[model samples]
Structure formats: structure tokens, C-alpha cells
Target chain A: MKFKNFLYIIFLTTYYSFSQENNSSINGDFINNFQSYNDDPLIGAIAPEEKVLNNAYLNVIYTKNNFSIGLRYESYLNALMDFDSEFQGNGIPYRYITYTADGLEVTAGNYYEQFGSGLILRTYEDKGLGIDNAMDGIKLRLNPISGVYLKSFIGRSRTYFNYSEGIIRGVDMEMDINEMLRIENNGSYIFGSSIVSRFQEDNNPKFNLPQNVAAFSNRLNIMHSGFNYYIEYAYKFNDPVGSFSLESNNYAPGKALLSNLSYSKKGIGINIESHWIDHMEFRSERAKEKEFIINYIPTISKQHTYTLLALYPASTQMEGEFGVQADIFYKLKKGSLLGGKYGTKININFSKINAIKNGTSFLNDSLNIRSPFLSYDNDKLYFTDFNIEINKKLDKKTKINFIVSNQKYNKDILEGKTPGEYGTIQSTIGVVDISYKIKKGHTIRIESQALRSKPDPNATKKGDGHWVMLLSEYTISPNWFFSIQDMYNFGNYDQTQRLHYINATFGYIIGSNRFEIGYGKKRAGIFCVGGVCKEVPASNGLNINISSSF
Target chain B: MKRYLLFTILFFFLSQYIFSQEKLPNISVKNLNGKKVNIQDINNEGSPIVLNFWATWCKPCKLELNTIAEDYEDWQDETGVKIIAVSIDDSRSMSKVAPYINSVGWDYEIYLDPNRDLARSLGVSTVPHTFLLNEKKEIVWEHRGYIPGDEHKLLEKIESLVK
Candidate 1:
């Protein structure tokens, strides 16, 4: 009730003050996801007590000349499966007002921000992953000089309907070397530095902890011709916090280093990246989890699109990790022997991650898990992947894509499973997709995927057996689309465990409105977008989705 | 609380009556070469412009762009239109964008909005969102999702505008 009253006050003030502006515009978007569930014995899916679950969002933005006001209304009623139950009822969780003029901009209420590669600070929203960490506060951006940019913010990170206990404050500056020095060469250089600090009350009874924790990052970028090199190093002060996964209280200062080099031309591109991280997770509320995260360590692995290949996607560890990833993309010219009538595009990627060695043996309790730079434990491998993908146009009317992937996932280490419970999974995946345009305004696409796993006596349910999936989609001009897919665990030795997940869907799109409905069985697995991940439970259900913007 | 909610609903509807043409804001986005380019400074040479917000990992977005590529040259010749592809890929995937677009032979101008600042300002929460601008560079039409053969509808919209 208090929040409502506050908003009412802000709304009236803005409306009455801005009513005189004639060049005003209002825009918004709405999305709703509804699901109805059924009990599935084989997949271990039980219907929720409510039987139906839904999540909906509506965002409205009003803008006129140099001022804007926006708000987002969200309703979960009963949250969907795999969604945080804390998102209970409905409220306006995001609202902001902004004004900009003459190279100076100010935003108050709520905003998202990021600094150089997001190593020390990044706040964003990924609706698909149900992660929105927008900060509610005041932000100022200024470009007083041509080659210099400055930003500063002080706020509290959002956690559902509430805000984190800690207060976050950050400042960043970026300077362009060429513009600052008046150099005339085409080459480019930009240097940036950021400092982020969080303040929370120290309430622990057992140990003394710092009430204010600060982190700093320095970054540089060089771009000349087709080559680009970038790096950022971040260091965090001593912060004693809880690690939920390890079930331990940690007292350590954290640090991270990330670098990337890439070269791109008309027909080819190559990139190499490396990261060394240690206990660098910064959250607005130290004891809280994903909801209060204040920073993001950039992920380097290739995010696969195929179902089987994506099953073992890589993610960041909150404690310590070191990894390297590389990718190469090339295009075979048209009329060549391999390209045939059209050009062929090929991409190859490799990534590996390992745990960093802890320096606890030599350090005191206050800095217990601090490790030296770039040294990783040889035995604690986390994940590794190598994949190749090829896309080609067979003719004017048809296109095909092929992907082959190999991965080794350490389930025991990643999931924090104790000894004898699970083991590593060594698997290979292959996918083929073909899209054909029957004629103008009509198209059909078919995809097939296969995954084979090496047999191991200690394998767990996740490492069970081989799987195959097939999908077909048909579309009719500008408005309608239909698709069907089925995935089967064909290699399961136990007949009762061999289940087929089948689904079908159709969608209609008109201008800015989209409507989709589907009924299907969904297998339990980890769903990830970018580097963020979440576990989804198996279910059988009917889903309806609608979105519109105006 | 109910009264406040009711007031907001009424205000929202009342503001709907105040609609007017709005142009792109004066926000900065980086190009492939890492130089900042203000959104308001892009010049289309009096031709219609189409800005498509996309990401590297979105399948529908890729499909939409590829399908449009097949007729891009002809469409430009007919209506003098060009697409400016704005990528909303975050820090992790931003580098992959330049290579991906080049390897796929897309000639569209590519800009990076790593923090999604441009997208948020434009009220674009979904990928494959497309905006069509008139010769005056004012957004005249918008589309949220892409379906097969959507390019033809886009072309029709462009032709009517240019006519």
C-alpha cells in the first residue's frame, strides 16, 4: 500500500508537469505465459496444487523530448515450474524516470548498468532465464569532453518485490586515446577503470567481517585494422560470505583476469579468450544467491543451439576457476569445389575449464582461499568441449547445417555431489538441419540430433544413455507457423526408462502481436542463456504465450 | 492501494490519447571498429531505414535476417532501403557478432549495444524486433516477431511508404 501511494505521487507529479509537452509518445510491451499441467509418472512430474501456473509482464514507457518515465508490472500469481516462488503476487517491480540534455543524462528510480566486459559490474534482465537485477537508485552519465565518458550510480539491487539489504555504489570512466591525443591514424585505443563497493551490516555472531567491500577493475582495448585485443583485471577486497554450494563460510579476497583477442575479415574470423577467476562473486546481499548478484564474469564457451549439444553447457563457478576458449569462422567462396552453387560457412570452437588451486595451505584464515595468479589444480577439471559447425546453401531454395560436438562434463564436481554418487560424462553429439522453401511465402524445415555417451559403471541418471531427436517445422507466409518434435532415450537399457518427449506447437504473428500455443512433454534439464543457468523439472503440459507491443 | 492502481490504469489509458511521432533518441552505440556512434547521428541519405534488433544466439533472428538477405539487393534497388542491424548481444557474445555477420555475408551495417541501452530506450524486449522508418527517419511501423515470408510484407510496407 505504501509503494502504491508513492507511485501515485510520482505519477501525478510527472503527468501534471509534462502535460504541456506536445511531442509526447507512449509505448509498451506485454507478454504472458500460461501453463496447465498433468501428472507424468515416467518423467516424475507431479501436477502442482494449483493445476495452472502463469507469469505475465507489462512494460510502459512515456517519452517526450528529453524526458522519459517507465514502469513494468509483473504478475506471477503462482510462479511457473523452475521459477523462484518468491515471485508471488503482482506489483510494479521496475520503474524509472529519466532526463537528458546537452551531453548530460540522469536516471532515477531503476536502471541497468555494465562496466568494461562486466567483470566487476553488470545488471541486466534476461526474461527467458527469469533474471532481472535492475538496480533501484540514481545514475548519472556525463560526456563533458569529446573523448571521455563518465558514469556513476548509487542504488540497491532488486530482488523480486524487494531490494537487497546492501547498498551498491560504482563509478566508471572511459577515455579514447586517439580522440584525446588528436591522433589521425585509423587505429583505436580505449582505456577504462571502474570501482564498485557494497555496504551491508555485519550481523554474524561467530566472526568479524567487513561491513563495506570494494572491488576495482582496469581494462584496455586496442583495435587496429581487423585485429582487436581487450583485457580487464578486477580485484575485490576481503569479504566473508556464505557459499551455498560448498556449504562453507568463506573469508577471502577475490580477483579475476579476463582477456580476448580477435581478428575478423570479410571471409574469416578468429578469436581466443582466457579467464582466471577466484572467489570473485559479488552480491548485494552476501548471503543471498542469484537474486542479488552485483557482477558478472564474462563466459567464454560457445553457447550451442542444438538440444543435445546444449545439454552440457558450461557455466561459471562462484569459487575459483580458470578457462580458455577459442573460435574460428570461415566462409568458403561460392562456385568452389566444397561450396558448390553457394558459399559454405564453417565454425570451430574449443573450450576448457578447471578449478584453481587454493592457497589455504600458506595463507591465514582472513585470506584463506586466495590463490596465486593463473595456477589451476591439475586434477579438478570442470568441463571441456570441442565443436564444429557448417552451414551451406544446397541451392537457391534449400539450406542445410551440420554440427559435430564432443564434451566431457564433471557432474560430481559441478553439482557438488559426494563420492560414489556420480561421475564424469563423456559424450558426443551430432546435428543436421535442413530448410527448404517450397516456393515464395512457403517453407519447411527439418532437424535431427543424436547424442551418444560412453558407458560407465558409476554413471548417474543424467549420464544414462544415447538419445535422438527430430523436429519438423512448416510455415505459411508472414503469419502462421507449425512445428512438431520428438526426443527419445533410445539407448536406455531399462525399457521403463526409455521415454519419448513429444511436443507440437503453432504460432501466428501479425504486425506487433504474436500468439503461440503448444502441448507437450518436457524433459528435465538445465536451461541456460548466455552464462546464466537454471534447472527445470520434467513436466507434461499445455502452454500458451502471447506478446504485443505498441 | 486499489485506488492507486485504478488511478494508474486510468492515467495509462489517458496517455494513449497523447500519441505522436517520435524519433530515435540521442544514445551512443559502438560499431564493429569499437567507435561510439550516436543513434541520432546515423544518416540514411533520405532513404527508408529498417532497424532490426537481434542477437547471435536467437534462431528466429538469424532466420529472419538470412531470409531478408536473399532479397536485400533487389529491395534496395527498388526502394532505396537499407537495414541497420543492432545487436543486443552482451559482453560474452559481442565479439562473435562481427565474425558471424561477415561469415554469413550480411552487408547490413552492424552496431553493438552490449548493455542493451538502445534496446531498452526503444521498448524492444524481444529479439527479431524490426522497426521501419520513413525517409524522414521517423519510425512509422514496427513488427515484433518474424514469420516465414515476412520479408515480403516488409517490402510491401517499404514500397507503400516510398511511393
Candidate 2:
């Protein structure tokens, strides 16, 4: 079938379905983002090959009964400034048809699935980072009995516009014991297990590889009224990865353990989580870096929304890392001494990650290489964060939130930069947010933030020093909103490097459609989603975004 | 392969026109307490339901929920209704969900769709997406994104259903 003819068939079918005006529904959404770039040598904002770029996506879905079909059309005219150039053309990258009937569901084409905590398998998409690892294949889900769910799939992970060389097959089964037993109870218990295998023909003549690798995960969840606990363990067979030479073989089996416990009652909530993984980098194509990932290793850290605080995010070290995090939330009742007229809320969070102690005697070999890591040790810190925030309403028209945080970041291992280049970054951050209601439908919010970090003596490795930021947002009842924010690096050791990033945004919304336009300077940083990182280059320009759904 | 996918989609589009029904999908999601819930059973005691899909990182979604929370009591009194706020935050931010909800003190029933199965099933591509369901548990209306006064429009829809 010719490509043009295929598109014609799609359009014709869509038109016919719409013209019928029957019980069927055709719904779609479109998002168009256009940006004009400007070059600023000072901040290293280099002009792209194209001065202006547009990234647009359209999703259309038709559904009737237990049958549904959807397709996503993506176009990157000249590709966004920093997006991979391979996405410069227009294509239908995602298309799937699913049918669910008689307690069975089947999908063919493309789909996303996750097993356990995604320690073993996860296929997903993140449009902001232009990463879509969706599997193109057939999937089946069955609910043969009450409270029992079974799912299996066979497919190839997507890599850009093409599919990877590895063939993937997996099956998962989960059962809610309480529900299956037909017990009308307050507490529940669930158990799940998954097995996945991948196959790829070895093409490297110099090294032998495992043509087939399998992984298995077992999970358990127990929930009582206000308490919840979940635990999952995964193991992977030996798989050789990374650069390999004939002189030495680098192959290792992978294993991970993850657990989370939480209790929430009334106005108090507490959660604790820990994870340990070793030799757990699982990917479809071993040669592909930063892409074609097959499994997800989570980074146990708070996702900071503040600009300065987010500058140095912790990236999950897939090779070997042990981490733990705890969060506490408490709310004071209204009319209490410290609660004022409205209740006051307090949140405390702390997280730390460290390099696992290697099994091999490191006296002879340098520990810098990825091969030596096997066991976990608490002495070497990879990242640490302690933060506390308080939110209170002072009066009927005013509210305030204050936050303080201390952090330790190791850039060398996390970013794969030169070892000992910047050593580690130790910093403190403070934030104050205030919201005031001028009238019933009028409101304004102001945010002030400061970040101070210890600077390195080396000029080349010196980090951006003390920073301050202020943001203000004003909104009127329904249709209009405006915001202005600025961040300044005032204490940089090199005065010439100190710069300010100022941005202003305006938005208008009508029904299901929204339009936003912004002009600003975006600092260079790593934007991450689900532990996947993408480099966002520094740019100064005008950005226009419009999205509508029907 | 691409041609095959296109052909499959076309086949479904044509077939759905003849048999499509306006009932909500029975996709499963998890409540804030980690209990599995079927979207089809959200209609409690045959009451109209407001199904809102949101995320913690979405500014507009937060604003919409906050605005609705402030007036939820009056709205419920006027028309007996229930609201189910679904969060599509992936596993990356799922841990913070319970604490975040407590801090806001929203009384609405909340659920987590970590993998977005329900969102995809409902064709929701953006945050702050809302759906209004009749007493029959059928989706009657939906709107995406939110402005400050969207709650008013939502309340009106519920009132019509109540009548």
C-alpha cells in the first residue's frame, strides 16, 4: 500500500464516520508550539539552523462499544532547536486499535505498559523530551475471574521513527486476594508477578553476547485503613552491555529491591521508601546512549518546581545505587492556636542516595569504572536533600508558604562529567510564597527564592554561585492570567558570568482551548521525566503555545 | 508495518460508527488509598459525577481544583453530586500525591492513574480535563483545560443533570 493511499483511506473513513452522525464519537486534540530563537553569545544561546521552529501534535480517537482506535500525528518543522534532528519530518508515530469484551482486552499496533514499579519493564512516552519508547506490537489483557488481572504482550520497543532490534515479550499476573475471596473488608492484600524476556541477534564479531536475556519481578501490596505498604523484587539474567573489547568480557546479572511504607490518618501523613539496585542498566540497544531504555530506575528525590532549586536534579544511577527517602505531612486544625482562622500545613522531606560498596577489592583497581560496583555502602554520598515547608493562611484574603532546604549533589557521577571536576555541590535554598485575594475574583501571588552554594576554587569547574529569584502572578476571574519572573546570579565569582533570566507570560483560555505566549531566556539545564534526562540548550526567544481538545 | 497500522485504525473507525455507545470506559484506576477502582462504578447511588483529570505539576489543574474546593459545599447542597479528581502523575511523582492532597484539604474523592490508562481510554490528552456524567454513569459532557470561573460552568452542567 502506498503511503499517500493509506492517508486517503484514513481521511475517508474519518469523514464517513462523522457524516453518519450515529452513536459513535470522534474526539481529537491538537497542540502547536512555535518558537523564535535569538543568539546570545554571552549565555551561549546559539542560533539554530532554522531561526524559527514549530512542534505540533494532533491526536484523534474514535470509539464505539468496546472498540476504540486512536492515532497521533507529530510534526517538527525543522525540528525544535534542541530536539533530535531525526524528528524533523511529519509522521504518524502512534496508532493503536483496542477492543475489550467478555472480560478480555486486546490491543494491536502501539501501546505503553509497566510492570511492578517499572524496575523490570516500562515503555512510555515523554513528548517534552521527544522520547517515545512505546512498543509496537500486540497486547492482551484478561480478567478471567473476579479480582484477577492478566496481561501479556509481544513487541519491539520504538526508537525514533523505527523499532529497535530487540524483540520483547512479557506477561504479568496480579490478584487482589480480598476481592477474589469475596470478602467485604476494610483491608486488602494484593500479589503480582511478571516475567519478561528479550531477544537480539549478536552482530559484534569481537565479543560474544547473550542472545536472549530474561527478567522476573515479584511484588506484594498490603493496605489497611490508613496504612499502605508495597514491596517488589526484580532479577535479570546476565547481559553484556556497554563498550566491549576482546581482551575482557563485561557481563553481569542485575537485581533490584524496592519498598514503600506509608500511613495517613486525619491530617497527618507519613511515607518512607527505599530502593537498592546493582548492575541494573537494561536497554533495548546496548550501543544507544540515553535512548531505547527498556526499564525505569527511579530517582528517589523530591521534584522541586522552583527554578534555582531544580538546577541540579538528581539522576538515577542505573549501574549501582542505594537510596531512601521519607516524607511527613501534618495539618493543624482550624481555630487552633497555631492554625489561625484556616488550618496550617507543615511538610518535611528528606532523601539520600549513595554509591554501593563494590564487591571486588578496590585496592588494585580504580573504583571510578562502572564494572567494579556490586554492593551497597552508605559512606559515599551521591545525593542528599532535607527540606521543610510551612503553609498558613493569615487572614481571609491572604496566605503564605515558607520553605527551607539543604542539598548535596555529586555532579561527576550523576552527569557523567569529568571526575573531581566540580567535586560536589552543597547548597541551601529558601523560598517564600504569598497569595492575596484582592476581591472575590481577583488574586495575586508573589514568590521569592534564594539559593546559595559553596563554590569550587577551580575557575573551570566553578559552579554558579548565590542566586535570587522573584515571581509574581496575577489572575482575573476566568479568561486572563499573567506572570513575570526573574532570576539573578548576583554572587558569581566571575562578574562577567553573572546574568539574569527574566521571563513574562500571558495566557487566555476559552472553553477547552488555551493560548499562551512567553518571551524569556531559558537557562541551560537537564530536563528529566521519569528518570530520563534530556539536555535543554540555553535559548532566548518568543514562545507561543496553543492547545485545544474536542 | 506502518501501512498495517493505518489499515487497522481505518477499520475500527468504520466499524465504530455502527455500534458506538455513549457509555464510559471501564478502565481501572487507583484511589488515593491505593484501592483499585473502576471508572464505570464512580456513579455513587446514581448521583451525577464530575470526573476531573489533573496533575500536581499542572498549574491550571491546581487552580481549577482549588476554585472548585472553595465552593464545593454550596454546589453539593444545590445539586447532590460527587466529584472524582484523578491525578495522572506518573510513578516519578506518585509518592508525593497523598501529602499534597492533605495539604490542600480537598474533600473530593481522588484517584491515581499512574500509567494514564483511564486518561487514554477517555481520549484525554491534557491536564485539567473534565467530564460530566449522568445518573446512568454515561459521559454526557466534557471540557479540557480550566479558567478561574470554569467551576461555574461545571456547576451549571451538574444542575441541568440534576433537573
Q: Calculate each model's fnat, 2 decimals.
A: 0.61, 0.30
A440-471, model 1: which lDDT tens digit per residue?
A: 88999999999998754665545557899999
Candidate 1 segments exceeding 4 Å error: A1-21, A242-249, A359-369, A455-462
Q: Which 10 residues in a row give candidate 1 chain A its minimum summed lDDT? A: A359-368
lDDT of each: 0.84, 0.79
lDDT of 2 by residue, A1-550 (tens): 3554365456546755566455555666688999999999888898786899999987777765566777787888978876888877778878888888998999998899998778889887767888788999999999999989999999999877888888999999999998799888788899999999999988777777888889999999898887888888998887765345435555557778888888787788888998887767778766566687888877888777677667778888876788899988888888899977777888898999988776212211233333333356766788899999787768877878788999988877777789778767889999998888887657898999999999544424877788999999987756778999998888887899799999999998766678999999988878866556778899999999998765
Best by lDDT: 1
Q: Is the docking of candidate 2 incorrect, acceptable, medium or high quality?
A: acceptable
The numbered model that scores best in TM-score is 1
- What is the per-residue lDDT of model 2 for residues B81-156, given as tens digits with 9 covering 90 to 100? 8889999987666766776776567898999988887787676777889988888777777877765556777888
User: Candidate 2 at B143: error in angstroms?
Assistant: 4.6
Question: Candidate 2 regions off by >4 Å?
Answer: A1-21, A242-246, A359-375, A456-460, B1-23, B32-35, B56-67, B99-105, B135-150, B160-163
